[model samples]
Target: MTRALISVFDKTGIVDLARAIANAGIDIISTGATARVLAEAGIAVSGVESVTGFPECFDGRVKTLHPLVHGGILADRRKPDHVAQMKELGVEPIDIVIVNLYPFEETLASGASPDECIEQIDIGGPAMVRAAAKNHASVAVLTSPSQYGDAIVALERGGFTEEERRVLAARAYAHTAAYDAAVANWMTELADEEPQYVGVGLPRTATLRYGENPHQSAWLSADGKGGVANAVQLGGKEMSYNNYRDTDAALRAAYDHLDPTVAIIKHTNPCGIATADTIEQAHASAHACDPVSAYGGVIAANRKVTRAMAEQVKPIFTEVIVAPDYDEDALELLQTKKNLRILKVTPSEEQRDITQISGGFLVQARDQVDQAGDVFAGWDHVAGPEADEQTRNDLEFAWRTVRSVRSNAVLLVKDGASVGVGMGQVNRVDSCRLSVERANTLGVAVESDVDTAGGAQAGTAASEERARGSVAASDAFFPFADGLEVLIEAGVKAVVQPGGSIRDAEVIEAANAAGVTMYFTGVRHFAH
Candidate 1:
C-alpha cells in the first residue's frame, strides 16, 4: 500500500483528509496531536514513533527525524538503487508527505519569552517536508490543511503527477524559506544596531488572482510577528494589486499624526488630511479639504472608526477605508457598501521598513514618528508673531502633513482642517498655486468654514465667511518671499512652518509685511 505521512500545526481539515486517505487504501502516518486526531476519528494512523522505533523524547521535540522517515520520503521509486536501499533498510516509501510547520510567527508575536519562541520552532516537520519535496518526481508534499482537500482529491484521481508534485514542492521550499526568514529576523532584532542591515521576514497569507495588472500574479504575505501592523483583512472584495499599494500609502499618511487624524489619499499622494476636535470633525475637515480629489480615493484614519464617522463616510464613494478598528455601528454601516474594501491594520510588533533594490532587500528602522511637542521651546514668536491655542493646534498638524508630502510641498490648514495642498512640484511657488487651486476646487472657504457655517445661520456674507477658513504651511524653509507671497494672495491668513531658510529674516519680514501671523516650530520635518 502507498504510504502518506501527515504532520501539521493547523488542523483545519485534517480528519476528513485522513479519512479520505484511509478510504483510498493508503496507510496514514502522523505524529503527536495529528496522530491522536486521526485515531480518534477511527482512521488508522501509524505513529512516527512506532515506525522509527525512537520514542518522541525531549517533550515531543525529537520526532519524525529518524532514518525511517527520511529514508521513506527521500527514496526514488524510479531509481533502482534507491528502491533497493529503501527495501534493504526496511523502509516503506512515503509516497505522500503532508506537513505544516510550527507557529514560529505566532510564538514571536505573542510577546512571549525568547525561550518560548525557540521552543515552538519545529525542526523535524520542516526536515520531512524538504526531504519529500526534494524527491517530488516520486512523492507528493502537502504543507497546509487548506490544500489538503485538493491534494487528497488529486491523489484519489490516480494520484498526483510529477507536475502537481513539483508545484507543491516549490511551495514547500518557499514556505520553509519564509519560515526561516521570520525566525532569523526575530533573532537578529534582539541586537541593537541600525548601521548593519539584515533581511525581510514574512509568510505568504494568500495569492491574489493577479498583480497590479491582470497580466501579472502576486501573493499577499504577512509579517507573522503580531502587532498593530500585522497582516490584516478588514473587509472588502478581493483586493486588487493596485488597492493594496494605494491603501498602504494611505495608512502611512494616516498614521503620521499622533493625534486623531484622517487623510484622503489618491495614487499614493495625500489629497487631504485634517485634525479635528473629534474624529468626525477631522473627517468633515478632511473631506472638505479636497472634496473633488477625494472621490474614489482611499481613506485612512489614525483612530478607531466610530459610528458617526462611518455614517458620514457611507455617503461618499471610496475604494478603501483603513483604520485601526471599526466599531460595531461603523462596521454595520460599512458592511452595506460591499464593494468598498475595509482594511484594519493595528500596529504589529513585527514591522520592518523594507525597500527592494536591484535584486535584494534594503531594510531599515521604521522611520520614527516625531511628535510636534515643545518644538517651540524658549523662543517667543519674534514678538507680535504668535499663534493662538486653536491656531497652534492646526499649525502642528499642518507641519506634520508637510513632511509626509512630496518635496516642494505646500499644505493649507486651519482650525484643525486641511484646505488644500500642492505637492511634487519643481518650485515652491507651483506648490502654492496647486494648493490654492485644489482648495478652490474643493469649495473650501477662502477664509473660514466656521464663519460660513455660522454666518449662514445669521444670513451674512457667506462668500467672505467661507474664504476665511484656510491656512498654509510649508515643508521646508521659505527660500524666498515668492511662495508665501503667492499663498497670502490666495487668502491664506495664518502660516506655520519650520523657520530655517538662509533668508529666514527675509521670509519673516515678508510675513510681517503681509500682515499675517507666522510661528516657527524651530524644527524641520523632511521625509524622503
Candidate 2:
C-alpha cells in the first residue's frame, strides 16, 4: 500500500483530503496538530513519531527531521539500489508528501514580538518539501490547499503522471522560496542593516494583454498590499499597461493634498491638478488649467465621485478614473461610457521605490513630501519681502504639487490650482519658459474683454494677466539666474526651490531686483 505524509499549518480542506487518500488505500501519517485533527474526524491516521520510532522534541521542531522520514520521501522508485537500501534500512517508501510552512508572514504582519516571530519560522517543513520536490520523479509533493482537490482526483485514479508531479514540485519550491524570502526580509528589518541581497517573491496576479507596446508580452505581480494592483474595476474595458502607469501617477498626485482634489495625468506627468471645497469644483478648475491636454487623460479624485462631478466629466474623453468610491448615480452615469475604465482603490502608504535596470534593480526609500521636514518649517526667505497669506498658501500648494512632476520641472499655481506645468525638459531655463508660455496660452482667461481685431495681442495680455501673482515651484534649485529671470519676467510673484546651488546668490539677486518673494526649501524633489 502507498504511504502519504501530510502536514500543514493551514488545515483548510485537510479532513476531506485525508478521507479521499484513505479510501484510495493510502495510509496517512501526520504530525502534531494535523494528526489529532484527522484522528478526531474519524480518519485512521498514524502519528509521524510511529514511522520515525522517535518522539517529537524541542517543542516539535525535531519531529520530521529524522532520517527514516526523509529516506522514504527521497528514495527513487526507479533505482533498484535506492529501493534495496531503503528496504535494508526498514524505511517504507512514501509516495506522496503534502506540507505547508508555518505562518511567518502572517505573524510579522500582526506585529508580533521578535521572539514570537522567530518561533513561527519553520525549519523541518521546508526541508521535507525540498527533499520531496528534489525526488519528484518518484514522489509527488503538494504545498498549497488549492492543489489538494486535483491531487485527490489523481490519487483516486491510481497516481499522478510524471508531468503532473513535475508541476507540483515546481509549485512546492516556489512556496518554500516565498516563505524563506518573507523570513529573510523580516530578519533584515530586525537587524537594522541594509540587506546585501533583496529577495522579493510577489505572486503573479495578472497576465496583461501587452506591455507598453502591443508587441511585448507582459504581466503584473503584486505583494498583495492595497493599491491599484488590487483595485476593483467597476466599469470599462481591460486596463492597458499605460493606463495603470498613468492612473497610479494621477492617484499619487490627488492623495498628496489634504483638501478635496483632482489630478489629470498624461504620460505619467500631471497636466493639471487642483484642490477645492468640492471634488466637482476641483475637477473643473484642474481641467480649466489645460482643457486640451485633459482630453483622454487619466483622472483621480481624493474624494468619492458625486453626480455633480460625473456630470462635469461626461463631456470630456477620459481614459481612466480612480477614486475611493462613487455615488450610485455617479457610477451609473460613468458606466455608460463603455470604454472608460473606472477603478476604486484604497490608498496605502508606499515604503520603497524600485527601479529595474539591465542587470538588477535599484531600491530606495520613497521620496515623500512630509519627509522633507515640515513643508515650510525649513524654508529660508532668501529674497524680497515676505509673501502675503494668499501667496504663501499658493506657494505651499505649488511646492507639494511639483514633487509629482518629472525632473527639471516647473509648476505655476494660482488659488490652489496648477495654471501651468512644464516638465521633462532638458534645462531649467527652458522649463521656466515653457511654464510661462503654457500659463498664457492654455490657462483659462481671467479677463473676458473682447479685442478680436488685435486677437494675438489681446490673448497674450490676458495670459500674462492670469499668470501675474501666481506662485512657482521648481523640482530642484536654479542652476543659474536665467531660469529665475524667466519666471520673474512672466509676472510670477513668489517662488520656491531646494536652494542649494553654487549660484544661489546670483539667483537671489535676480529675485530681489524683480521684487519677487523667493524661499528655499533646503530639500530637493527630483523625479526621473
Candidate 3:
C-alpha cells in the first residue's frame, strides 16, 4: 500500500485530506501535533517514529531528519539500484509528502523575542520538502492547504500523473524558497549587518492586462502586507499597469503632507499637489494647478474622501482615486463613474527599495524625506536676506514636494500648493524654464487683472506677477548659475536645494545678485 507523510504548522484541511488518503487504501504517517489531530479526528494514523524506528528527540526536531524518512521520499522508483537500497534499508517508499513551514514572518510581525523567533524557524521541514521535490518522479510534495483538494482527487483516482507531480514539485520548491528568504532577511535585520546577498520572494497576486504597452505581458507581485499593491478595489473597471503606477505616485505624494492633501498624477509624475484644511479644498486647489493635465489623471487623498470632494471629482475624467477610506455618500457618488477605479489603501510601514538592473537587483533603504525630523532645521541660509514667514513656509513645502518629482526636477509653490512642476528633463535649465512657463500659462492667477489672451505673450506680465513671491525647490544643486537665473528672472523670491555642485559659488552669487533668499539643505533627493 502507498504511504503518505504529513506534517504542517498550519492544519487547515489536514483531517479531510488524511481521510481521503485513508479511504484510498493509503497509509498515513504524521508527526507530533499533526498525528495527534488526525487520531483525534478518528483517522487511523501512525506516528513518524513508527516508520523511522527512532523516537523524536531535540524537542521533536530530530524526528523527520532520519535517513529512513529521507530515503523513502528520495528513492527513484524507476532506478533498480535505488529501489534495491530502499528495500535493503527496510524503508517504505512514501508516495506523498505534505508539509508547511513554521510561521516565522508572523512571529516577527508579532514582536516576538529573538529566542522565540529562532525557535519558530523550521529546519527539518524544508529539508524534507527539498528531498521529496527532487525525487518528484516517484514522490509528490504538497506545500499548501490550497493544494490539498487537487491532491485528494488525484489520490482517489489511483495517483497523481507525472505532469501533476512536476507541477507540485515546482510549487514545493517555491514554497521552501520563499520561507528561506524570509528567514534570511530576518536574521540579517537582527544582526544589524548589510546583507552580502539579498533574497526577495514576492508571490504573484494579479495578472495585469499588459505591461507599459499592450503587446507586452505583465503581472503584479507583492508581499501582500499593505500598500498600493494590496489596495482593495471598490469600484470601476479593472486596473491596468499604468493605473497602478500612477496611483502609487499619487498616494506617496498625498501622504507626504501632514494636512489634508491631494495629489493629481499622470504618467507616474505629479501634475499638481496641495495641502489644505479640507479634502475638498485640497483637491480643488491641486486640480487648479494644471487643470488640462488633471483630466484622466489619478488622484490620491491623505484623508477620507468626503461627499464634497466626491462632488468636485465627479465631472472630471479621472482614471483612479485612492484613499484610506470613503464616506458612504462619497463612495456612492464615485461609484457612478463605472470606469473609474477606486481603491482603499492603508499605508504600510516603509520597506527597502529594490530596483532590477541588467544582471541583478540594486537594493537600498528608502529615501524618506521625513527620516530627519524638520528637514529645514539644519539648512543654511547662504544668500540674500532672511525670508518672511510665508516665504519660508512655501520653501519648505516646495522642498518636500520636489522629492517626489523625477530627476532634474524643479517645483514652484505658493500658499501650500504647487503652482508649477517641471520634471524628467535632461538639464536643470530647461526644467526651470518649463516650470516658469507652466506657472504663467496653466497656474491659477494670483491677481484678478490677469491677461486673457491665449498666446504666449498674452499673460507675460500677469505670469511674472503670479510667480513674484512663490518659492522654488530643486531636487539637486544647480550645476551653474543659469538655472538660478531662470527662476530669479521669472520672479521667484526664494529657493531651496542641496548645495554641493562644483559651481555652487556661481549659483549662490547669482541668487545674491538677484536678492533672492536661498537655503542649502545639504541633502539631495533624486527620483529616477
Candidate 4:
C-alpha cells in the first residue's frame, strides 16, 4: 500500500485529507499530535514510534529522527539501488510527507520569551519536508495543510504530473522560507540588531485597486487592525491606493499643527493646512490656502469633525475626510458623497515608523518633533524683529508642514494657510526656486479681492486674482540669503523656516532690508 506521513502546525485541512488518503488505501503514518488528531477523527493510522520501533525521546524532539522516516522519503523510486537499500533497512516506502513548522510568527508576535520562541522552532519537520521535496519526482511533498487536498487528488488519479510536482515543490520552498524568516526575525529583535531580519514578518496589507494611477499595481503594508489599518469609515466609499497615500500625508500635516488644526492634501502635498480657534476656522484658512487644489482632496480634522464643520465641507468635492469623532449630523452630511472615503482615527502620535529590507523588518520611533522657537545648534537672526505672535505661530506651523514634505522641500503659508508647496527638488536652492515658481504660477500675485460673487466654483485665474499678499515656508534652515532674495522677487512678503544655518544674519539682514517679515520656527521636518 502507498503510505503518507502527516504533521502540521496550521491544521486547516488535515482531517479530511487524512481520510481521503486513507480511503485510497494509503497507510497514514504520523507522530504525536498528528497521530492523536487522526485517531480521534476515526481514521486508521500508524504512529511513527510503531513504524520505527523507537519511542519519542528528548521531550519529543527526537520523534521522527529515525531511518524509517528518512529512508522512505529520500529513496529515489527510479533508482534500483535506493529502493533496494530502503527494503534492506525494512522501511516502508512513504509516498508523501505533509508537514508544517511551528507557529514561530505567532509566538514571537505574542511577546514570547526567548526560550519560549526558541523551543517552538521545528527541526525534524523541516528535515522531512526537505527530504520529500528533493525526491518530489517520485514522492509527493506537502509542506502546508493548504496543499493536502491537492496531494491526495493527485494520488487518487494514479500519479502526480511533473508540473503539479514542481508547483508543490516551489510552495514547499516558500513554506520553509517564511518559517526560517520568522525565527530569524524573533532572534534578531532579541539581539537588538538593526536590519537583523528586516523585511521578514511584514504581510502585504492588500493589493490596491491600483497605484498612483490605474496602470501600476500596488499593495499596502500595515500592522493588522488598530494601526493604520483600522481607521473607521464615518461616511463615503472605499479608498483607492492613491487616496490612502494622500490621506496619510494629510494626517501627518494635521498632527504637525500644535493647536487644533485642519489640513487638506492633494497628491501627497499640502494644499491647505491651518490651526485656529475651531475646526471650522482652521478648515476655512486651510481651504483658502489653495481652494483650487482643495477640490477632490483629502481633509483631516485633528479634533472631532462637527456638524458645522460638516456643513461647510459638504459643498466641496472632497475624496476623503478623517477625524477622531463625528457628531450625528456631521456623519449624515458626509454620507452623501458616494465615493468620499470617511475615516475616523486617533491622530497618529509621532511614535511609529516602519522600514522593510530584503529579508526582515526594521522598526523605530518617530524622530522628535522640531518646533519653531530656536531649534538650532546656533540660533541666527535673533532680536532682528522678534516675530509677531501671529508670525511666530505660523512659523511653527510652517516648520511642521515642511518636515512632513520631501527633502529639498519648501512651503508658502500666509495668514495661517498653506499657499504653495515645492518638494522633491534636487537641492535647497532648487526647492526655494520651485516654491516661488509654484506660488507665482498659482497664487503668487495676491488678488484677495477677486470676485467670489461669480460663485465659489469659479475659474482658476480669477480665483488667484482674489488672493492678496505673499508668505513663504521653508523646510530647513537657509544656508544663504539668495533663497530669500528669490522669494522676494516672486512677490512673497513674509517667510517662515527653521533657522539653523550660520548665515542666518545675512538672510535676516536681506529680509529686513527688503522690508519683508520673517520668522524662525526653530525646528525642521524632513520625511526622508
Q: Provide the clash count, candidate 4.
A: 21
lDDT of 4: 0.73
**RMSD score of candidate 1 (Å):** 4.3
Instruction: Estimate, for each residue in 50-152, the C-alpha lDDT of model 4 and write its tens digit.
Output: 8889999988788888888898888888899887887788878888788888877667667788888888999999888888888888777887665666777
Q: For residues 263-343, could you state the per-residue lDDT of candidate 1 as single tens digits?
A: 888877787787765676677667766656778888889898998788778777889888888898899899899888887
Q: Supply candidate 4's per-residue lDDT for 501.
A: 87
lDDT of 2 by residue, 470-496 (tens): 999999999999999989988999999
* Tens-digit lDDT track of model 3 for 275-315: 87788778877776777787789999999999978977887
Measured with C-alpha atoms, the lDDT of residue 313 in candidate 1 is 81
Error of 3 at 506 (Å): 1.9
TM-score of model number 4: 0.74
Assess the local accuracy of residue 381 in candidate 4 as a C-alpha lDDT between 0 and 100: 39
Error (Å) of candidate 4 at residue 278 is 6.2
Name model 2 segments beyond 4 Å from true: 36-43, 55-62, 193-197, 371-374, 445-465
Candidates' lDDT values, in order? 0.75, 0.87, 0.86, 0.73
